[model samples]
Target chain A: MRQILHILTQPNDPLAAKIIAAQRQEPDHQVRVADLTVPEADYHALLQEIFSSDSIEVW
Target chain B: MKPSWLLIITSDPRTSARPAEAIRIAAGVGTWKKADVSVYLRGPAVLALSEFADEFIDEDNYTRYFPIIGEFGRPIYVEQGAPRLAEIGESPMRYQEISDVELAALAARHNHVARF
Candidate 1:
């Protein structure tokens, strides 16, 4: 399984939604979406997780 | 030695005053703190360059603060592709136009970056 991380800076960003939908269609991909509009500590933790993932996309 | 800082202000003053206030205070205090500062206005933040900026009179009046920033010998840059750029052609205030690549280069040159 491929691990994919999506870092979205804006709330309800359309691009992030589209990417999530596309990844959901792929059965072999595990996709996670991290909204960067959160608190700084939460954002750092999410970033750390993204660094550990197989692939990452930022929007 | 003072550290160089890139202050990227991308918030719309129409929506909230927090971002404008943040830039105002940063530029105001950063100068006395002896930090070399640069400002880049992008997105809705470019609207701050319009003549309408003078009408913005709050307790922190960002319009007034901007000139103080310039007096501190800090270079202010406006993004070439900012939506409001054409509406306010040739800002009365001292600012240079920069492309996305140039903006990236400026950020890379700075020791630290703060985005509003």
Candidate 2:
């Protein structure tokens, strides 16, 4: 199963692209990002997706 | 250097992308201590590299946000985000060539990813 790492919350333009460059480890991983205008539901879904993973912790 | 968590974004997320009650807490420097800062700029926010820059339309021409960052002493980087800023010219920040493959990899490396 492929897991998605949601960095979408962190990117707002160049940063999103930058984060896209810096993160992610293996092939089965995915990174999602957003901009000035992202739907609330979509954002929440990203977090929920992570929680379903082996574990989800925000520090 | 402080234990930085990696700040990968173009403009100040607080003022540029996400607008909150002005209190999401940055990773040190301004009001906090023990915060290591490493910012990377790319995409649209890259435009912020020149954001809020003082342009002396009077002088030949100079409009960019680097001067402010320099004063603030924040270590920021610009990659493809630089070329997106202008057609051509030297930007104050250094540019890093990023790819989808690279971005995906970075997301997994950081402890957390918070876009503004």
Tell me, by lDDT, which candidate is best.
1
- What is the C-alpha lDDT profile of model 1 across B41-106, one tens digit per residue? 887778777665644434246666767777766567988876688776556577788876566445
All-Cα superposition RMSD per candidate: 8.5, 8.1
List the candidate 1 regions with Cα displacement exceeding 4 Å.
A1-59, B54-60
Error of 1 at B103 (Å): 0.9
Q: Report the Cα lDDT for residue B88, model 1.
A: 67
Cα deviation of B27 in candidate 2 (Å)?
6.9
After the best TM-score superposition of candidate 2, give how far the Cα of residue A57 lies from its true spot, in angstroms: 9.9
Q: What C-alpha lDDT values do all the predictions have?
A: 0.67, 0.42
Q: Which digits, one per residue and each the tens of the lDDT, describe model 2 over residues B1-116?
A: 44334445534432343311111234223334454434455655554444333322211112222333344354454454345568334555544555555544544544444443
The docking category that best describes candidate 2 is: incorrect
